[model samples]
Target: MLSPTLITVALAAAMIGALAGVLGTFLVLRGQSLLGDVIAHASLPGVVAGFLISGERGFVPILAGALVSGALAGLSVQLLRRGAGVKSDAALGSVLSLFFALGVVLLTVAQSQGGSAGLTMFLFGQAASVLRADLLPMAVVGGTVLLVLVLLWKEFQLVAFDREAARAQGLPVERLEVLLTLLTAVTIVLGLSLAGVVLMVALLIAPAVAARQWVRGLAPMVWLAALIGALAGSGGAVISAMGQGVATGPVMVLAAVALTALSLLLAPERGLVARWRRQGAARQALRGRQVLAALRGLEGDHATPDYASDEAMLQAYLGTDAGPALARLYRDGLIRPAARLAPEAAARRWELTEAGRLRVEEGGQHA
Candidate 1:
């Protein structure tokens, strides 16, 4: 029995997630990931500045202020890059610190004026406070952001993968780069407006990272990231509704955290656990092959016939590293061990069963 408000909040969160994912993918692939974080954190001061000037709390003017400030932060980083020798990371860090510091100062000033409880909400975002009125803006902006992202996909890929080539191809590398920065800023600001600057980066980044693990192409990545974002948002909204005083922003972030961890361990090729397992399997196969070659050497059987001679030859080839794996292989019918042949164990060589040869071929494909 979820409320309509909770459902709307979740829908909004999912849209935001999709927008973040779309631009976030490009940011990460282009190695500008930290910039997104910088922009997200930097937007707080803009929000406070907006509130100070407009004397209000809702998204309209505040988000406008956020966009202005966000763009400035993005532009400042670019100016730093062009005007000074400061590297991108340093420039981004400098902007983040300066903007956030300014925000804190503005917030302090605004709080001194009157009831600060309402003003403080922007600092950590009160997503559960979101109403149906907020839906149209999120939908409008989110839709525009995604449409532009898809239309410019090819250009972005070139710039991200090979800047020099994009330049050589006359793809407006520099312009597109700035345009991307602005998009990243906008996307970040959207999340910051809901999740607060502190957790904004998670919303903008986690879904994209998770999506990357699942897809090879850009389109699927964006879609998947959006789905995850929406799910997290909706789930957080539900949690907040049932629990007394549960913060919506933090709950959304926690849901994102779960997805991020799941992707890191379970997502296809790029997952942490998957890679580790692949490496372990590869190492075992290599050792098994070495043992087979060694067995052939000890066999003195020029043609190296079959599985009957493995027991005696295990001593010559199989060692501590392969003992457990080899034993498992034996039980699985991949290999026949020489262990049963005691005397003249040199002739007691292991032989590859059909499964072992297929494994070897599979290894060759990888090579």
Candidate 2:
């Protein structure tokens, strides 16, 4: 029941998402996540210029402008960081703000001139308006970016994980960095028509961040991030098509955020819920061992047949939560109440069973 145009738009968005996800993984690992944001915002001025020069909304021209603008912005950040001694964050922020403001001013001028009326759509993206012509450019650019990433995978990974080591090996670390930055700039440019400047950062980084939580290896993380980003892009497009007045970019970002939240709560090893469960099990095991150790210690110290078996003594020895441990130990035949104890006695004495003594002697209690 879906229309052809809608299908094309969805596919383009997915391609953009997959490309962004792959490149963004390195950005996240290199601690340059904010650099992605800066590149995205910086593309705006070039986009506006592209429209002005072409005098129409042509995907290729606009994309070319975007690529140039984005690269300059990314290079500016690097120069400021390395040459001017500006902090990385400050450089990124300064360039991002400056380019975005310049783009805004150009946008206003173009709007007043009355030739670029539809230019505002690129500000937040209008995926619903994507045409067949848009798909070709997206496929060509996205495919090229992906191919390059694969060809330089080892170099990029080396630089990202350990720059000092890469430099020690004489691996041309600075060239690799610049290449990676340009790659990221291209990605942001490609995504401009789909997710825009602001939402594109979320598209770039969220899937990678989410995938990192579940995966330890770089290869697995990259593929998983691409898959997740594709899903968000396609799903957001579909949802926007079905809804009224809803923007495609924001919806895609929300979908990515939702997946991230799910990963945070449910992923193994690092998830909040998993960590809580593990800690609870560990505490229980520790308490059980403590009770066993306490029972073993009391036998020789007290002359009352075995030792203090009363709730009061156990509580004093192991805090107020000793009852559960005591009950668990008794169930395991590690400890039991002393013989001839009154049923109504408030403080019945207890002793460790033979199994309990052997367990303590062998250090099995620590197990």
State the lDDT at 47 in candidate 1. Answer: 83
Q: Each candidate: RMSD to true structure? A: 4.1, 2.3
Stretches of candidate 2 above 4 Å error? 303-305, 330-333, 337-340, 346-350, 353-367
Off by over 4 Å in 1: 300-313, 316-318, 321-367
Which pairs of residues collide in candidate 2? 309-349, 309-350
**What's the CA error at residue 50 for candidate 2, in Å?**
1.6
C-alpha lDDT of all candidate models, in order: 0.75, 0.85
| lDDT, candidate 2, 228-336, per-residue tens | 8999898888888888878888888888888889998999988899999999878877887777777767766664435646666877988766877777778888888
After best superposition, candidate 1 residue 33: deviation in angstroms?
Answer: 1.4
- The per-prediction tally of clashing pairs is 12, 2
| Model 2: how far residue 57 lies from native, Å | 2.6
Give the lDDT of residue 235 in candidate 2: 88
Which candidate should be chosen as best, given TM-score against the real structure? 2
